[model samples]
Target chain A: MTSTTLTPSFDEQYVATRKVATVGRVEISDVTKSYGANTVLRDVSLTIEPGQVVALIGPSGSGKSTLLRAINHLETVDRGSITVDGRYIGYERKGDTLHELREAEILRRRTQVGLVFQNFNLFPHLTAIENIIEAPVAHKRLTRDDARALAEGLLARVGLADKADHYPRQLSGGQQQRVAIARALALSPKVLLFDEPTSALDPELVGEVLDVIRGLARDGTTLVIVTHEIGFAREVADRIVFLDHGEIVEQGTPGQVLRNARHRRTRDFLAKVL
Target chain B: MSRIVAPRSETTAHAAGAATPATDADATTDDTTSASSATADAVAKSGPAGGRLDAGLRVVPVKHWGRWVLSAIVAFVILQFLWSLATNPQWQWDVFAEYFFAPSVINGLWLTLGLTVVAGVAGFVLGAVLAVFRLSKSPLLGAAAWWYIWFFRSVPLVVQILVWYNLGYLYPTLGLGTPFTTDFWIVEFPTTTLISAFAAAAIGLSLHQAAYSAEIIRAGILSVDQGQLEAAGALGLPRSIRFFRITLPQAARAIVPNAFNEIIGLVKGTSVVFIVALPELFYTVQVIYNRNQRVIPLLLVAVVWYALITTVLSIAQYYVERRYARGSVRELPPTPVQRARRWGAEQWNRLGDAHTAAAPPPPAQPEPVVTAAAAASDQYRTGGAA
Candidate 1:
C-alpha cells in the first residue's frame, strides 16, 4: 500500500474556512465542560481536520468519551463553544450574537457527524439493512428503493451482505459493531466519532471490530477515536493524544509519543501498557 | 542362620530407614487394590441381579401414609358439607331452575354482553385518542385530554349513568339534526328525545372505561424504548407514520395485557346498569327474586353464570398475554429445560464461531457515491443559503 502523506497543517486550513466550506472540520475552542462542582473538562481545546485520523487515548473516566459526546452536543457544556465544519453546534451565533442552539437544531446538525457507540446502539427492532437505511431515509429523505440500494451496498461493504435480514440479537458482537459502522457511514458523515469501538467485544472478537475501523482510517474518513487499543493507535493514527484528568497532557506523532515519550506521565502510561 | 543373626544389627538399621518408605508404597498399593476391588464388588452387586430386584421393587407402589391420611380428612369434610347442603329440607332447585332460564334473565344476559362489546370498543378508541392527545406537543390538546381523563375518572359510574339518563331534564328540547330552522336548513329533535336505557348504560360504561383505558394506553406508550422514538426521528419519519409504525407496534406488547383486564372489568361493570332499569343480568335476577322471594336461589344462578363467563374471559386473557410475550425473553418460547439447553448451546456455538470467523474485512470499495451525494446536497443547501 502506498503511503499518502498528509500535511500537518491540513487540519488548520480546514478549520479556517469551516464556516464557508461545504465540508468542514470541527473546531473546539477553549471549551470547559462541568457538571455542577465537578469539572469534567477544563480549558480544553482541539481542532480535528476534515480527513485526519486523531486517536484520543486515556484511562477510564478521563473525559475522552465526554468530549466526543460534547462535539455532537449530546451533553451540553457549561461553558464552551463547539463548531462542526463551520456551523456552531453547541453554541449558535446569530447576527453577531451567540446562543446555544435549540435541541431540534442540535439534533439536525448531529446528523452531519455520526457517532458509533461502544455498545453498538443499533435499534434492536431493525434488521441490519434497516439499521443502515433508517437515518438516510428518515433524515435525508431518501426513497425506499434508493435507501435499500444504498443500505445493501453498505452491508456488502461491511462484509455482512448475506446477513442483511438478521437482527442485532442474531448477529455476534463483532457483526453488530460492523453493522453499526455501516449505519453511521450511511449518513456520509464528514467526521466520524468512535467511543471505545471494541471495548465491549470479547478478546477474540475485538480484532474484527478493530480491523473494520483500521479500514476506515485507510479510506481517509476523518475519524476521532477514543480507544484503549495501543497497538491500533500506533499502527493507524497519524497523531496520538494522551489525555489525563480531561486535559491533553501530551500529543505527537504515534512513534514520538507512544515509543519515545518526553513527558513523565506519557512514559508512565506507556510503560504500564507496553 | 548363624550368618543371618550376625548381620541382623546392620540389616535392622537398613530396614528401619526403608520401613517408612516401604510402608508408604504399601499403603498406596493397598488403597488402589482395595478401591479397585470395592468398585468391582459394587459393580457385581449392582449388576443384573440387583437391577432386577430394584426393578421389581419399583413396580410395587410405595404408600405415602401421611398424604393419604390428610387427603382422606379433606375428602370427608367436603362430603359432609355437600350432604348438609343437599339434604336440607328447605333447599330448593325449583326456584334456581325457574330463574336460570327465565326470559327476562336471558334477555338481561344478552343486553349485558351487547353493552360490554359496545363500551369496550368505544372506550378503547377514545382512550387511544386521549393518550395520543395527552402526548401531543400542543398544550390545548394535552390539557383537553387531561381534563377529560380527570373528569371521567373522578366521577362515579353510577352518577354518570344517572346524569346521562336524566340529560333530557337538562335540555328538554334535545336538539339534533341541523342548526337553523329554515326551508333549506331545518331539523329538529322531538321533545320526547331518543336517549334510552341502553344508550344511557353505554354512555356511562364507555366513559368510565375510557378513563382506565387512557391510563393503560399511556402506560403502554411509555413502556417503549426512547431509542425507538429517536430512530424514528433520525429517519425523519413524519409524526403520524412514526407513531403508527414504530411507536404503536412496540407499545402493543404492553397494551394487550392491560386491555384484556379492562375488558373483563367492563363486562362485570355492565351490571351497574340496573340503576336505570336496564334488563341486564343483575337487574333481571333482582326482578325474579323479588317476585318469588327465593332470593338465594335466584342469586346463585346469576353467580354461576358470572363465574363461568369470567372463567372463559380469564382463559382468553392468558392466551393473549402469551402471544404478546413473544421475543421478550432471552429464549423465545422458553421452557425451563429448553432455556437451559439454549443457553448451553449458545455458549458453545459462540465459542466455536469466535475461533472460526476471520476478522471483519474493511470497506473494500470507497463509498464515493454516498459521499458524493452528501457533498452535493451540502452544496445545494449552501447555494440555497447564498
Candidate 2:
C-alpha cells in the first residue's frame, strides 16, 4: 500500500472536488443503556478523535453494538450523553441541562452519523443507485439529478457501477454490503457506525466489504465498527475497545489489548477467538 | 465387420420396439427407425470399434389407460352439463337477453358500481388511518382504534344499515355543538334528511368494510421486516418518508390481494341494500321479476353480471400483485395475454416440427450473464458533497 499521508488535509489534495473536510470528533460520556432487566451498557465512556478508527470487539451480549447504536441515536442511552463534533445527539444543550430534541431535530443530527447493519438492510424495493439517492434527496441536500450523479460516483467507488440498477435481492451478499457502504457514504456522514458489517457475509466475500471499510478508514472519517474480524480490526483501527457483559473490559492499542491484555477476562475472551 | 454389426443392431432395435404397448411416447417409431439408420451408418463408418453402448435401443413408456378413461368420462360429463344448459327451455334465454341490457337494469348496474367505488375508496382510506392509529405508540390512540374496529366488526352489516336508516329515532336532529349539549349548536340538520336509504347503505358498508380493511392493513404493515424501517431511519429519512416510501411500498405486497378481496366482496355485498329499496343491480332485477313474474331469467341476469364483475376484479388483482412483486421476484409472472401469446407461439412451432422429427429441440431461456469483477480500491471515500 502507498504511504498516503494520514492527515486531515489529505482529502483536499486527492478528492478535492468531491467532499469538504470531515469533522468527526466523537465524545461518549458515561453512557449507560438497558432494556427492562438487561443492562446493555454500564457507564461506558470513550472519545475518538477526528479521522480516527476504533474497533469494538466482544462476545455476544456485550455492549459493543449498543454503544455503536447510541452514537447515531439509533439506541437511546438511559443516562449520559453522546456527541459528534461537540453537538449532542438526540438532544440539544439548553444552558446547564440537556433537553431531548424533537424527532425532526434528532433525525437532522442523525444524518451526520450513518449506520450500516449486519444484515446489510438494503431496501429491497430500491435499486442500488436509488438506495443511495433516497436519503440525500429526501433530506433536500441535493436535487434528484445531483443525488443520482452522486450515487453513480459512490457505486463506482464501491466497484458496483454496472450494478446500479440491480435490486438488493438480485445481488450477492458481498455486492449488497458494498452498496450498503456506498449508501452510508452518500450523506458524507461525519461519523460512520458499522455493526457487524462483515458478519453476515461468506468468508470469500468478507474481503470485498472489508476492502470498502478499509478505504473509508484512510479517508479521514471517524468510524466505530463492531466486528469479530480481529485481524482486519488490528490492521485498520487506530484503537481497539473490548467489552464484556455490558461493560468495557479493556482498551488500548491493538498490540496492547491483543498481545498483552491487562485484564484476565479480556485475555480469556481473546484466547477463545484467537 | 459392418455387415455383421448391422444385423445384430437391427435385431436388438426391433426387439426393443416390440417390447412395450404402443402409446404417445417421446420416442416415436419414426425416431426409432432414424436412430437405427444412424447406428448402421456409424458402424459402417468406424468398423467394429464404432458404436456406443445403449445405441439404437428404443425405450417405451408405460401407458396410463386409467387416466385416459377418466379424462374421457370427465369430458362427457362436462359436455352433458353444457348440453343441458343449451337445451333447457326453462332458462328463458330470450327473456334473459332482453332484460340483461335494459335501460333500467343498466342504470341499476351503474348505481351498484358507483356504490362499490365510493365505499371501497372511503373504506380503505379510513382503514389506513385506523391502522396507523392502532400501530402508534400512544396507548390512548391505539385503544380508540382497537375499539372502533371491534365495535364495527361485531355489528352485522344489515343491522348497521337499519340503524343508520332509522337514525332519526335515535336522534331527531344531529348538530355540531358543545360536547353533550345542543344549546351551543353551530350547525344543525334533521337526522331523517341526512340519513336516507342510500346514505345509510354507504355508511353501513364503508364502516363495515373499514373494520376488516384495518386488520388487513395492520397485518400488511406488520408483515414488513423491521430492519427496513431501521435502515430508513439510519438514513435520516423523515417520518413521512419512512412510512410512505419504505414501509407502505413493502406492505402493499401483502395488502393488495386482501384489499382487492374486500372490494370484490363489497361489489356482491351491495345486494343487501335491496332491503332499503335503493334500486341497485339486484334490487332492479327483483323489481322487474316481481312485475313480470319472470323470476328465474331476471335472477340469471343478475348472477351473470355479478360473475362478470368478479372476473374483472380477479384480473385486476393479478396485475396489481405483479406490480408489487417488482423487486422481490426475479421475473414477473407473465400477464394473461402474454401467456396466451407464448402458448400460441409454442403450438405454431410444434406444428412446424411435426414432420421434421430429426430437428433438435429449441433451447431453453438463457441464464443472465454475470459481469466479471473489476477490483475497486480497498480504500473507501465518502461521496462528493455527501
Candidate 3:
C-alpha cells in the first residue's frame, strides 16, 4: 500500500523552491474558545516547527479536535491568536489592535492551511479526482489542466490511481479517507491538519489510512493530527501533546509523554488507553 | 394432473435466481418447461410417486379476494364512463378533433408554454436571489426578503394580475430618479404603455411563483448536509463556488422534484391569466366556445393539451431527477424504457425456449461475493435509501 512514487517529487518541491514551502511553522498562543458557558479550549498554547509532525492525543472532550480546527481558523477563538509562518489566518494586525480580516481575505489565507475531517467529508457530488481539483482550480492556484495533473499525482501518491472517477460513495472508508488526504494535498497547503482521520473508519481499514499519513510525514510536510492511534503517534510524530480537560497536560517526544509521563492525569489517561 | 405436476416441478426446480416464498408461485408458473432433466432429478430425489404425481408439491398462490373485487368495480366504472363518452353526442368528438390541432389553438398552446417558461425562469432566478438574501447574515436583507415573500404570497394571484394591469391608476409613469422626488427623472415610461396585458400577466405570475420558489430553494439549500458546507469552507473555496459547485448540486437532489411540482402547478396556474385577456390555451378555448356555442368539446381540447404538456414535463422531470441523482443513490433505478427492453428480452428468450421444447436450463448464476466494494455500496444504499 505504501508506494513512494510521488513522494520524491513532492519532497523536492517543498525542500527546493518556495521559501515557506517546507517551513510551515504554526503558532498558537493563549487560544481560548468557549460555547456559551462551556469552555472547550482553555488558553491552549503550542508551536509546531518546520517539517514537524505533531500528534494531539486525548479523551473525547479534551479539545484535541478543536485545537486542530482552530489552527485552520475553522473555529474562531475568543482569546489569543494563531498564525502560520508568522502571518495571521483570520486576522491582520493594524497598529495596536488585531482586526479580523474580511471573508474574502480569510478565504485567501485559508488556502494555506487544509483540514481533513473525521468523517472524510469528501464532496459527495464530485468524483474523487474532481474533489481533489475543485479547490485548487476554484481558488485559481492552478489551471484546470495543472490541477487535474496534480490531482492525479496526489491520487497516485495515496494509492488510488484507478479511483479517479469513482464517487465517494463508491469507495470504502479507507479509500475515501485516502482520497481526502489527496484532496488536501492538491491545494499544496503549507500546513495540513487531520481531525481524527481514522476515527470514522472500520478497524481493519485504519491501517491503510495511517500508512498514507506516514508517507506524508516523510515528505517534509508539516502535519498536525488529532488521533487516538497511540502506536501510530509514536511511530510518526516528532512531538506528542497530551491534553486533558481542555488543557495541555504534557508535551514532549512520544517516548517521554507515552513512556514516562510526568503528570498523574497523563499517567492515568495513558494507563486506560494503553 | 400428473402431466401438470411433472412440468411444474421441473420449471420450479430450474428457476434459477428467483426470489423464494410467496411470489415464487407466480414466477414459477411463468418459467418455461425446458428443464426436463432437472425434473428427472427432482423425481429421483422425491423417493417414490404417490398417485402418479411425484414431481413437486402444489403451490397455491396467496389470494386477495378484496383486490379482485375492488379491481372489478374500478374496471367496470372506467369502462362505463368511457362507454358514455363514446355513446353521448354532446362530447362532439368530431368538433373536438377539428380544433384540437387548429392553427389558432396551436398558437395559444405555444403561448401557454412560452408564458410558463418565461415566468418559471424569472421566478426561480428571483427566488434564488431572495433565498440567498434570507439566508444571509444581515438582518435587514433577511427581513426584506421575508417581507417580499410574505407580500407576494398573501395577495390572491388574480388580484395581483389585475393590480399589475391597472398599475397606471397608482403610478402614471415609472421613472428612475431620486427617492421621493420626481424633479430629475432619469428615464420614464407610461405605466400603461409598459405594462401590456401579456407583460402584466408575466409580471404577476412570476411574482406569485417567486414566493413559493424562494421557500423551495431555501429549503433545498437547508436540506444539504452541514458537513458539506464545512468541507467546502475548509477547502478555501469562494462563497460563489461553494454555492454553485458544492451546495447547489447536493441541494438540487432535494430541490428538483419539488421545483418541478411547482412548475407543473404553474403550467395549470397560467389558465387563470384569462382575466388579463392574454390569449393562452385556456383563454383561447373560452373564446372559441363562446362564439361557436360548442363548450364541452372546446374545453376537452384544452384539457387534452394541458394533459399533454404536463406529461412532457413529468417525463422531463424524471430524467432531470435521474441526472442529479449521481453519487447520491447507490444505483440509478432503471428507466421505464430500460425495464421494458429487459422484459422484451426475457420474453424473446422464453419464445426461443418454447420452440426447442427441450432447451437446456439456463446456467446457474454465481453467488454474489461480499467484497469491500459491496459493503461500501451497501453503506451508501442505506444512508441514502430515502
Tens digit of per-residue lDDT, candidate 3, span A98-211 = 988999889889988988899989898889999999998998888999999999988888999999999999999999999999898887888899999999999999988887
Considering only chain B, report the TM-score of each candidate against the true chain B. 0.64, 0.75, 0.76
Candidate 1 lDDT over A56-143, as tens digits, reads 9887777898898888766667776788877976567888888766655666677777788888867665678877876777665588
Query: Would you list the rank order by lDDT, best first?
Result: 3, 2, 1
Off by over 4 Å in 3: A1-21, B1-61, B343-386
Chain A TM-score values for every predicted structure, listed in order: 0.89, 0.92, 0.93
Clashing pairs in 3: none
TM-score of 2: 0.83
What is the per-residue lDDT of model 2 for residues A1-274, given as tens digits with 9 covering 90 to 100?
Answer: 1111222344324334223335999999898899999999999999998888899999999989889988988888899888899999788898998888999988888999999999999999888999999999999999999999999998888888899999989998989998998999999999999999999999988877887787787677888999999988887787999999888889999889999999999999899988
After superposition, candidate 2 runs with Cα above 4 Å error: A1-22, B1-69, B343-386
Better of 2 and 3 by DockQ: 3
Fnat by candidate, in order = 0.09, 0.73, 0.72
Ranking by TM-score: 2, 3, 1
- Tell me the spans in candidate 1 whose CA falls farther than 4 Å from its real position: A1-24, A88-94, A97-109, A137-140, A143-149, A260-274, B1-114, B121-154, B167-200, B217-251, B288-323, B334-386
> What's each prediction's TM-score?
0.65, 0.83, 0.83
